[model samples]
Target: MAAIDHFWAVIPAGGAGTRLWPLSRSSVPKFLHDLTGGGRTLLQDTRDRLAPLAEDRFVVVTGRPHREAVLGQLPEVAPDLVLAEPAPRDSMAAIGLAAALLERRDPDDAVMGSFPADHVIPDPHGFGEAVRTAVEVARDDWLVTIGIEPTFPSSAFGYVHLGEPVDGHPAARHVQEFVEKPSVAVATDYVATGRYRWNAGMFVVRPTVLLDLLARWHPAFAADLRAIAAAPERLDELWAGLPKIALDHAIAEPAAAAGRVASVPSAFHWEDVGDFDALATLLTGAGSVTVLGDDDLVRPVDASGLVVPAAGRVIAVVGLDDVVVVDTPDALLVTTRARAQDVKQVVEGLKQSGRADLT
Candidate 1:
C-alpha cells in the first residue's frame, strides 16, 4: 500500500515502566522489552504497526539514556529522526519537540501522529483506518485523536467524550471533552451512554497546527521549541526551563473544550501494558495461569494469573490465585494481580534504601 501523503509517525518512547519493575527498568524500559512474547520488542512492534501508513516518514523522541537502544530496536528508522532529549520533560516537551522539528524539516502540511512506544494494538488494520481518518480530519485544522472503545468500565484510563459529528467527516466526531480517570461507578455510567472512549493518547495533527495550538496556550514554551528547532544548538539550554507537563493537560483538554479536538472512535483492542496484570491478559489466552517466559521454568500448581521466569531459574508456585511472580537475575517481584500497580513502591523503597542498583 502507498504511504499516507504528508503523514509522519512520531513515537515518544520515554516511560520507565516502573509499574512493571524487575522486567522493565529505567535502563531498559518496557518499550524496549518483548512483553507479549511476540519475538519483537514493543518498540519494534510500534514501528511495524506504523510502517504501512507512514512508510519511511517516522520520527522517534526518547530520553538520552535510551537513544541507542531505540535506534538499535528500530534500525529501519533513520538515525537523524531518533531525537534524544537531555532530560525528562514529560510528554509535552518530548512530543512537542518532534512537532517543532518536523515543522522545520517538512516545512509543509505534514500530519504527525503521536503514538506512545509502549502501547499494544492487536489490530493494525483497525488502527490504520482510524489513523487515516484522523489524519484527514486533521487536515481540516482539527486536532484528532484515535479513541479506543473501552473493553470494560476501566477506572485506570481517562475518557474522551464523543459529541456531534463533523459536517463532512462521517468517521469523526467533535470531542465534547476529555475526562480524567473516573471512578468505576462514573466509568460505568460513561460506558452506558456509548459516547465515551478510553483516551489512548494517539494524536494526529499537522506539526505546525500542533505548535500553533501550543503557542496559543503556552506562547513561550512553543517559541522555545521552535527556536531550538531553528538553531539546533539550544536544546540543552532551553529544554530545562520548559514546563514539565503532560501534553493532555498542556493542550488536548483545553482544545477539546474549545471544540478544536475530534475523536475517531476505534474498535481495535488497545493495551497500555501498564503492569503485570495487564501483561498477563495480553500474552496468554483464557487459562488459569499465564507464563510469559519459558513455560518449563515455571511450575504452577493450583495457581492463577501470571508468572514470568526470565532469570533462567525454576519458579514454583502453589496454592495461590491471581498471583504475579517476576524473577530476574538481580530482582524478584512477588505480588498479587490486584496489587500489581503498587510495584513502583518497591522501586521507591529501593531508592530510599540506597539499593538503586536493584531498581
Candidate 2:
C-alpha cells in the first residue's frame, strides 16, 4: 500500500568460488563470470535487475581486490556506494559494516536489503515484486527473508521451516525454525512435508532493528561492530577482532528462535549457482551442445547434463553423462555431476600440492 522508497540494497560479492575451478578461479569468482548467454556477468545482471529501485540505493560490499571487477561490471553505482572490505571477515562482518555505513546516510528507519551477487534469478519481475513486499513488511520491525520454494531435495542449500502465516499477509509466514544443510534423507523428508523452503540468504530489514538483534543475541560481536562503525577508517583493525560467522548462524537463526523473523516465498525462479553442474543447468536449455575442437571440427553432441565452459580451447568429450568437463590451457577437470560439489576440495588439494597454476 505504501511506496517503497528510501530502501537500500547491499550486494555481497567477495567470495572466491573455488568449486568452478579453471573458470571460477581465485582471480575471478563465479559472480564475475558470464555464465548466462546474455553477455552480462552475474553481478551485472543483479544490478540490472534491481536498477528500477535506483543505482544510488544500491551498496556493494566486496574485498579490495574485487573492487575493479565489480566497478567494471556496475558502472552505474556511485564510487562511494561500493564499500571495499580491508580483509575477508565473512557475512556477519560485511553486513554489519554495510548497515553501519548506511546508518550514517539514513539512520535507523531506512530499510536495507542484502543479496548474494552470484545468484541467478530467472524471473526478474517476480523477484522485484517480492523484494518490494519484503521491504514493506520489514517496516514492521521484523527481519524479513526471501525463501525459495524448494523444488527438489537439495543437500547443498540450507532450509527454513515455515511457521504460521503472518497475519494479514497470505504470502508471508513466520519462520518456525532454521536448519543447516541436512542429510539426503532429511532433505527429502523436508521437501515431502512441503513446510520447508531453501534458504536463499537474501535478507531485508531496518539497520537499527538488525543492530538491535545482533546486540541482544551477540553482545561481544555487536560491540566490536559498533567500534568499527564509529571509526569507519579503522574497519580493517575492527574486522580482525570480529569473529568469522555467517549472518544466519550468528544473528538470523537466533532471532528466529526468539520469534522475531518472517519469510516470504520468493516467487522468482532462483539458483544459488554454487557449483559447475548447477551453473551448467542455468546456462543450457533442453540438452545439446556444439563443440569446436582443433582443425575447426564442428561436432554436435548430445550433452543432456554437462557443463562445458571452454570456448577457444580444444575439447573432446566422447562418452560422458552428467559430467563436468572443463578444459583450460593450464588445467582440466573431469568429475561426475554429483561429485561436482567437491570441486572446492580439489582446489584446496591443488593449493596444498603447490600447484598454484592449476588453482
Candidate 3:
C-alpha cells in the first residue's frame, strides 16, 4: 500500500499488563516482549504494520521509564517523535498530547491515527485499507474509528453500535453509540442484530479537530495539552493536573452522542493478547501443548495448554488439561486457562506481600 499523505501514526505504549505478570513486568511491559514467539516484539510489529501508511511519520507516547526501550526497539522513528510522559495519566493524556504536538507541528494538514502498541493485527493489508478509509472519512471533519467485525460474541470487548451509512462512503457508518463490555448473552444478542462491531480503540482524526472536540468537553485539559505542546517544558507541570481518563470516555463516547463520530467496519482479526489464555489461543490450537521457548525444555504427558520455559529449566506436565505454566528465573506461574484473568490478583498479592521484585 502506498503511504497515506499527511497521516501521523500515534502509538500509545504505556501499560503494565499486570495479568501477564513475571514475564511482563513494569520495567519491561508486555508490549516490549515477543509473547507470540514472533521474531519482533509487539511494539516493533505495531510500528512495522503502520510504517507503510505512516511513512516515517510516527509519534510514540510512552512512560519515562520505557522511553529508551521504545526508542531502542523503534530506531527508525525519530527520537523527538518519542514523547515520554513524566507520569502515567492514562490514554487520553497520552494520545491527546500527541494530537496537540501534531496540531502544532503540522497545523495545516496533520491527520493522526491512534493505535495501541500492544495490539496484534495479523493482516496489515486489511488493516491499512481500513485505516485508509478512516483517513478519507476523517478528512470530512468526523472522528473515525476502525471497528472490527466480531467473529463471535466476545464479552471481553466493547461494542460500537452502527447506525446508517455515510452519504458518500457506504463502507463507513455513523456511530450511534459506544457500548461497554456486555455479558455473553447480551453480546450474543448484539451479534445477532448485526449492528455492532468490536471497538478496538483505533481512531483517526485531524489533529486540530481532535483537540477542538476535547476543548468542547474539557476546555482546561485541552488548553493544558496545547500549552505543553507549545512550551514543551510545561508537560510535567500541567500533566499531573490532567484528568487520568481513557480517550473513549473523554471524547469518543461523547463525540458519538453528538453525531460527530463514524466507523469503518473491518474484517481483519485483532488480538489484544490480554492474558496467557489469549496468548495460548494465538500460538496454538486446543488439545495440544504449545511451548513458547525451547521445546526440549517442556515434557507433557497429557497436557493441553501453554508452557513457557524462559528459565531454561525442564518443565514436565502430566495428566493436565488447559493449564498455563510460565517459568521465569525469578517467578513461576502455574494455573488453569479458566483462571488466566485472575493472574493479576497474584501480582497484587506479591506486591502487597513486599515481593515487588517477583512481579
Write down the TM-score of every candidate.
Answer: 0.98, 0.92, 0.98
Ranking by lDDT: 3, 1, 2
Global lDDT of model 3: 0.94
Q: In model 1, how large is the Cα lDDT of residue 123? A: 90
List residue ranges in candidate 1 displaced over 4 A. none
Q: For residue 130, what is the lDDT in candidate 3?
A: 96
Write model 3 residue lDDT over 22-140, tens digit each, in one string: 78998899999988787899999999999999999999999999999999999999999999999999999999999999998999888999999998989999999999999999999
Pairwise TM-score winner, candidates 1 and 2: 1
lDDT of each: 0.93, 0.80, 0.94
The positional error of residue 228 in candidate 2, measured at the CA in angstroms, is 3.0
Clash count for candidate 2 is 0
Better of 1 and 3 by lDDT: 3
Supply candidate 1's per-residue lDDT for 89: 96
lDDT of 2: 0.80
Q: Residue by residue across 1-359, what tens digits does model 2's lDDT show?
A: 23358888889987777887877777777789776757788898888787776446889998888998888888889877888888888998888778877777788569998988988888878888898888878888889999898888998889999999888677788998889999989999999998899999899998888888988988888877777777877777777788788999888999999988999977579988888777766666544642212324323354444545455654555555666777666777878768888888889999999987667
